[model samples]
Target chain A: MPYFAQLYNFACWLIGDRVAAEDLVQETMLKALRGFSSYQQGTNFRAWIYRILRNTFLTSQTGLKATASLDSEDDALPEPATLETPESILLVRHEQSAIRSALESLPIDFREVILLSDVEEMSYQEISQALGVPMGTVMSRLSRARKAMRGLLTAASEGVKR
Target chain B: MTCDTWRERLDAYIDDSFPPEELNQLEEHLRVCPSCAAEALHRLKLKHATKAAAAARFAPSSEFRSRIAQGMPSRRKRLFGDLWIPGLAVAAAILIALAGSSVWEWHAQRQQALAELVDLHVTTLASVNPVDVISTDRHTVKPWFQGKLPFSFNLPELENSPFRLLGGKLVYFNHAPGAQLLCASGKHQISVFILQGDWKFALSGTFPASAREKGFNIESTRSADLRILLVSDANPGDIHELAELLKAAQQP
Candidate 1:
């Protein structure tokens, strides 16, 4: 159940639509079950499952439009205030929302690398295997993705100052 | 190293991809360069922020789960039904046409041949005897293929390449007798089946293009009238390589 929730969350982040993400995750789970006989146990099940989720999201016809809309809407949103006072819970929520919005604005490949590397804390080798790329490609993508994400956050922070 | 060099190395340093000496130099450069230090700090902070944002997880509604689960099997069954029903019907009609003459006996023989092909496929899969040679070595496997079939079937050395030979088994496909070679690259498995004879069968509008099937990726190509079907879980690019290798192996 915990695994499902984690996968569901990652799916939601990837697709940016809760309903569709859930459907993708469930489909991934079903695939994993059917192909379980072929699965090599004691390996990284999480990466295996995440790879399925990513593929499912990529192939979904409805996903393209939903992700586009989400990306646009996220870009239009304002950054959240970073005030740390206990009474400023709403401000924190706003900030978190803004951060999520910024994340959603990144390109799908960049966003995926960032999510897998930073968010999921997967190693470059694992990320490469899951994404079916070489280790060098994984490292380069992660570097580029982090640079892009940092630029976005910095811009958001600068926007608040302005 | 300059700050620019250190900046580029920063991510690798964090990933620990750098050697110990290079990493030490990177750390030393970061300590001395304020701009690089600030960049590293910003990167670290962003990493944490992104991690926190992703940790804000959400679950899919129960209704959505039920809907997807219900949809997949029906889709698969429908595909299988569409392919096999017409196939069975066509076989039945061919039998009816041949029932009255000596040609009917020939037709019966053809029908029997087709049935035997399907039976061969089922038996190979069912008995776990999918491969005659069970080594990853191309030399060993290729020799096992020698003197086994009438024509020379060249087995490429794919174990050194991306496609590691899993094993080879004799199976029937398209109502023709053939050899099925199973190979894997990483976690993806590819089943390459080579059959005898010169029949060119188009699978269009029959098996959903093999691309639509969720877990399996398949590609079929022919050489010297020998049909090869390569199916795998790898992406199309990698699978196509297998096809090209098979085609190359067939050459002088």
Candidate 2:
């Protein structure tokens, strides 16, 4: 049951729609069951399940939307904010909703890295395998993803201050 | 580490990906470099806030949990799951084991038989005496086997076909005397081995049983009183075509 909830939460974040997330999680469960024999024991079970779910999403209609949106790589690595630290802003006071909206507005790729790194706390190795990318790609993507996320959150907070 | 390098690695540092020695170096840099220190602090705050917000936002609803529970598959159905017949399960188990071994043995024998037939094909191609009657004429090849075998078989006319009649030989399969007609398609040689028997019992097949082993395509069929097996390394499609031709021309 805990496993299902975790998967559901991840799925909900990935697709950003409740009904679609439920259906995606259910399909992931079905595929995991059917191909369970191929899954070797004494391995990262969580990573294995996440990899399956990730693959299912990639090939799905929603995943296609995510892939299509990834084509606009112009803003993939936004410039880092170099202004003096806004210490007077007390960012954490307004961070909860600002950060959530920031994550919600970000592209699927950036959101994926943040969710894996910050939310799930998956290791770099596990993230590489789960996302089916090279280790170096995971590092660079995660770096860019975090930078992009901060940009979003900063922008949201600035807009709210106005 | 320089500020630029530390900037590139700030996320990894916070994610604790750096080795302890490198981490110590970065922390030493952070102590002196207030800019790098401030950047790390902001990154840490951002990571913390995002984790908390994502956790609070994406919790699966109770209804979703119930849906998943309902979708969970039950244990796979077993043959003896419900019914408990007196001594039935034991008898079934014994019968299954015997049947399994026999089926495996039968499959092994069939594979061995195909291998032997393939060997015969290779050896015949190399042998000096490939056929008892070496003739391309169907009329001559068809009659040369009379009185030598218990049954007669039809030979397809290959006058204009890609397959040319090379010759025919007398062969044995399972101690049963049969006719082996050797034919050719371009560079490939084809051997058709025919055994005489009650067609239905000998074949137990209405259609040709085809297999490929040891680089040879083999097709077996029953036509009239002959159990015909064709072996070749030629194209599989061509083998089936020749098999169909032989099946069509056999005397009813």
Candidate 3:
């Protein structure tokens, strides 16, 4: 039962629509239940279910759009490690909004890395298995994603300053 | 090693997944290079803030939950010639109800109330304007709910706490009016619901102190004749801090 909430949250973030995310999670659950026997013992079950959810997303319309943008160089954010993360940034309302909008505007690939690493707190290996990507790719994507997030936050705070 | 190489490793280090040898090198570099150290700090802060901002999320309603539960593939039904086992189970349930109906009803009612509370938490957060009485002062908000709800709950002193009193509003549960006190903890808004604790379906005192539903954490406790239920997406530690503060304030 708890699995449903986490899956639904993951699906919602991927699809960007509440209604669609519900349907996606329901489908994922059904598929998981029917294929329970196929799941081997002692494997990373969370990673396996996430893989199913992500795979399901990859076939959906929103996912196709994200796929198209995956290689689009124009969507890449500048590397921004210079910005300070002074815990108080989120304490302020505008800064909080800035962080959220920055996330929501990110390319789906970047967004997923941020979510998996930071929000879901999945390991590199687990994330690798879930996304069907190699460990190195997970590392690179997560690195770039954080850099991009930092970049956006910096820009948003500067905009507020003006 | 160059800072660029160290930068790449810092990301891995922040996740605490790097090897000991690599960590020794990274730690050595961090001591020498202020810029690299600052960059690492930036990533840590970003991860924390991102997690906080992404806290409030949606969950399926109770209807959808039961639909999934009932719809799960029953291995027994598959093996026992279809309806045969289900029919017998229902007969057994009827016999049990006749024997101790309150026990059966207790479980169902508790689940339903918790689900409804979570629903209210989500719905209130989603709505454009959440509370009727909007004030950050505990003195102001506590009195506002005095007449609106059947029971009163003490609003904790949040001066040194992570939470701040948001306000209160009247909410109905199972057609009974209750007080919903909203509190802000960082980026997350925690709802403290005080309802008549003496209702027929009183919690068994063994209610799990905390449970997560639809992305939010729901914690329940009883103070006098009032049931204090809190719902939020704040970090668990922060939730516990606020819960302790509330528990202290509810003291007679």
Candidate 4:
């Protein structure tokens, strides 16, 4: 489902570990299901679900003590391994992975806003609600996140050229 | 404005959050400043990359769905044998009388407690102290709770799910130490509170089991000696499913 994948991708990016991200997402869904009756209909379900995912990620005990790191060096990012990919599709996948790695390498605050805005396609207001921050904060964070992502991607590209 | 100022404003300009005058100024500055122009182009590329990465969505595997389903409490099982029918009828009859007697004192206390929890929930939504500790490892989250509360709580990592471990914070609910677990689903936030108490004291036939106040939903359930409360604006069905999954994870 779009809902599940969106959450999963956000989780993977947030935690930066696929295995841990998967577990956190599962718990998030479980909690979401239990509290389904309280969800307001016709409202922003994505925002609501995102809030749950954020909270679940924060409280999980798995690696809470590990200092937050921005290193994407260890991330075994999903590569396009399917056979018979058109050259264009392959190019697009490569670009996507590069961008993903760059995004993942940014600070948590930066990564969060970028994912919400550019990736998740959340409006500034929706991001403010999900992040429990002011709209200004969302805008500022997104701006910074984008800048950081650009710097990382540029650096990664240069490194590849060497 | 100088190039630096224009560069700073580039983000707002790109997002179209700037006023018309400011936007016009930024455009003029970019036209004259090649450095700023190049930076803007790079920023656009980054934005495109982010969009492309986000657009590549992945679905939850069938196994994950089955696992979540298995984790939830079976409503059908709860409905079998008309188990709660007699209890519900009896509860209905005594509801009025129970409101008046000291025999319902504990229920009143529990209601007050829930109200306090609702207050805490609202404050958390408005505050920045969502988690006291942040980590992605289960070992990190589990031990962090030690000595932070009057009792021990287990936090199993469900990395296979959408909820990634953002962090944990220590909070007080009803003057008792409570642990707040933070997890995320996409951009959504969910707060899980595990309280140490005897559920029997709180469920004494009078207190409402679940209620939605303000815009948030609060649900409490008991497993053995632990009482868990999930607070969010997410669908109640999702919360219930999460509770069941949590219960399953806690099992041996």
Candidate 5:
């Protein structure tokens, strides 16, 4: 019950539908409840459920497409601009709705990392558990996601010139 | 540490994931290096903005909460339960494990404050009579809290906007009495809470920082000695617009 809301929100963001997210969360909870014995004592409960939720999504209709795109151009990504520049300083406006579009436009892998790291404030280790990947992968994905986001937001703000 | 090395550790430093030994070393380095400090500030702002951008996330309705809650077994360990019949309690347990076992102390405290605020919002929603004072007029709503709270606040004129003032009630946040005004845009209800600014340090950094509690979007900012929070499942822009109005109302 404590983190029920966070799970539902994460599900909604991933599934992009309130109704589907609700079903997915129920299914995740039910699956966990049934698989309780399988849950190792030391495994993070939060990350374990998040992994189950993602696995559930992958098997579901909408998240199936996410798996296909998972291997999309990790190395082909453009090098991101650093925060050291004066021009980049002005691009960091929190109120820019363009940021939402920029975030939405990112690849699913990048978007998920951004959501887990930034929005949900999960640590690298926790995100690794949620993603079932090494900690290094989490770091790289987060780095690339921010870089990609910076690229998109910079372009967006320039277009609007606000 | 070299700036390049510091730059690599910047995200970890900003995220507060690096070890305490490295944390102090990094802070010492930042103290002498203006360039690194500016870069750190810039990186922190981007992180803030990215998090702020995600304020548009969907909030689950109370019905969903109830449905899931009721679906789970009330008191069973469910350790050996059949996999086909699942329950909601297990999921809740996992999500609550979100509390990083080793995270900084302040992070837990801030999360607690955000959780409390969310709980207060949820409690209000479930109540039969949500508001103590019932009136849409800003003039009436503003006066209702006159000595009930330690401080006073202004309510925006929602004259031609899509928003309508529903009413307000007195709330106790962190054991401090305050005012919570209910408003609506379209079908979503928004709770605008004005509380004594005792925990200002919890929400450090910029005035208007955003946080998530459950699935709700919360935009909180400080005005004078009062802290204003707007919570709703409404879109981020709508919540922000209402937040701006509240801030403007406080201004001359």
Candidate 6:
């Protein structure tokens, strides 16, 4: 019950369907209850449960399709310094809707890392455990995700002005 | 620091992963570099804005929560829901083949009750005020439960043992009033439930039959009308040792 709302929020974004997200959260709860016995004490229970949800999502039909859609174009990132400009101070201040759209438009892997880090406010260690990735991967994914998000917001703001 | 070096570590700087010395250097650089300053401000604003958007965007409806609660396996109305049955004879035949489904049903129900008790134990562990009386001495914990229950049970001496008497509380287990003695062995919190009821649920034996149920190793025993269940996440062997200690300390 404590993390239900947050779990549902993550589910909605991960699956991108309201009805399916609800079902996914329910399935996750059932699975967690069944496997609660295996959960060790003094470990990050939140990360443990999130890991189960991630594994469940990765195995679902939508998850498989989402995986296939992982674009390789952005794998080669420009130096982060190149993106630093004074214009970003104003560009990043777009409306909440703009931010949401930018977040939704990113690739699922990047979007997930951002959600787990910024929204859920999980530690890099927890994110690593939840995503089954190394801590370095979490940081790099977050860095790239934010960069891509900045580009999307800038483009959206430009479109709105024109 | 060069602009490139400062830029590369900017994300980690914002994340507070840098040591105090490196953070001071980054701060000094940010003060001197206009572009880097603007970038840091933008990232800070973006972080706040994204957190706000996420908080507002995808809240699950109240209906969603109710749907989940209804569908939870533990709260289902029946084990098998609305299966078509040809006749009572067929049902009877199936029950016979399953070695009397009523006994199996009873066992399932008992396990469910144990699961609820385990939930109660964990909840107690999670709560700040786990017990009514707080004391490390058995003398204090034993007397505290005097009027709390309709019955009384002896408390074991926890001295010179790994387990310490933390406290005791009054609780209801399966609608029957019971005294819950809270204990701690090393780092593990243990709940010993003393209820005034028949041992309707079988717990194997009085010699510390340690079996894991609902994430806790439960060591249960019965002496006359008193039924005691010790619940802990500690290893089963340690719990068994505690059980033996309890049996030896019980008054004759």
Number of the predicted model whose DockQ against the real structure is largest? 1
Could you arrange the candidates by TM-score from highest to lowest? 2, 6, 1, 3, 5, 4
> Which segments of model 3 are wrong by more than 4 Å?
A73-75, A81-95, B72-252
For every candidate, C-alpha RMSD to the true structure in Å: 15.5, 21.1, 20.8, 15.6, 23.5, 15.7
Docking class of 1: incorrect
lDDT of 3 at B221: 74
True contacts kept of each: 0.29, 0.33, 0.29, 0.26, 0.34, 0.31
After superposition, the stretches of candidate 1 with alpha carbons farther than 4 Å from their true spots are A63-95, B16-18, B60-217, B220-252
> Would you list the C-alpha lDDT of every candidate in the order shown?
0.59, 0.69, 0.69, 0.61, 0.70, 0.69
| Number of the predicted model whose TM-score against the real structure is largest | 2
Identify the CAPRI category of the predicted complex in candidate 2.
Answer: incorrect
Q: Write the per-residue lDDT of candidate 5 for residues B1-252, one digit (tens) a residue.
A: 589888777888778787887688989999999989987887787788767767446677877676666665434232222223434444544454454333223443455456446545654554444576788899999998898777888888998888999899876554457888889899999899998776644345433378765578899887777788888889889999998889889986
DockQ of 6: 0.16
What's model 4's interface RMSD, roughly to a tenth of an angstrom? 10.5
Enumerate the candidates' DockQ scores in order.
0.20, 0.15, 0.13, 0.15, 0.14, 0.16
Which digits, one per residue and each the tens of the lDDT, describe model 6 over residues B1-252?
578778767777666665687787889889999988877877877887788887647888877677655543223222112211223433353355357455444544455456546656765664345676899888888888776678877777678778888888776565456888888888898888877646345443322345676467888766666677788998888877877777665658
**CAPRI classification of candidate 3:** incorrect
Residue pairs clashing in model 6 are none
Model 1: native contacts recovered, as a fraction: 0.29
| Clashing residue pairs found in predicted model 3 | none
lDDT of 5 by residue, A1-162 (tens): 546777887877787777777777776776555444345577578877786676566545566565455544453444445553432544545344666677777777788888888888988988977765458768877877877776776666555565
- Candidate 2 fnat reads 0.33
Q: Give candidate 2 regions above 4 Å deviation.
A: A72-78, A83-90, B72-252
Judged by DockQ cut-offs, the docking class of candidate 6 is incorrect
| lDDT string, candidate 2, B1-252, tens digits | 479998899888888887777887899999999989988888887777677778746666777676556554223332222212223333443355456655433443464456446645654564444676899999999899899788788888888788999998776444346788899998998998878754322454432388886567898876776677889989888887888888888966
Clashes of each: 2, 0, 0, 87, 1, 0
What tens-digit string does per-residue lDDT give for candidate 3 at B1-252? 798888778888888888887678788889989989887876776677777777545566676677566654233212112112243444454466557666655654565466557656765664334687899898888887666565667777788877788787776654457888889887889888777876655555745688875467888777777777888888878877787788788898
lDDT of candidate 3 at residue B104, scale 0 to 100 = 51
What's the C-alpha lDDT at position B64 in model 1? 53
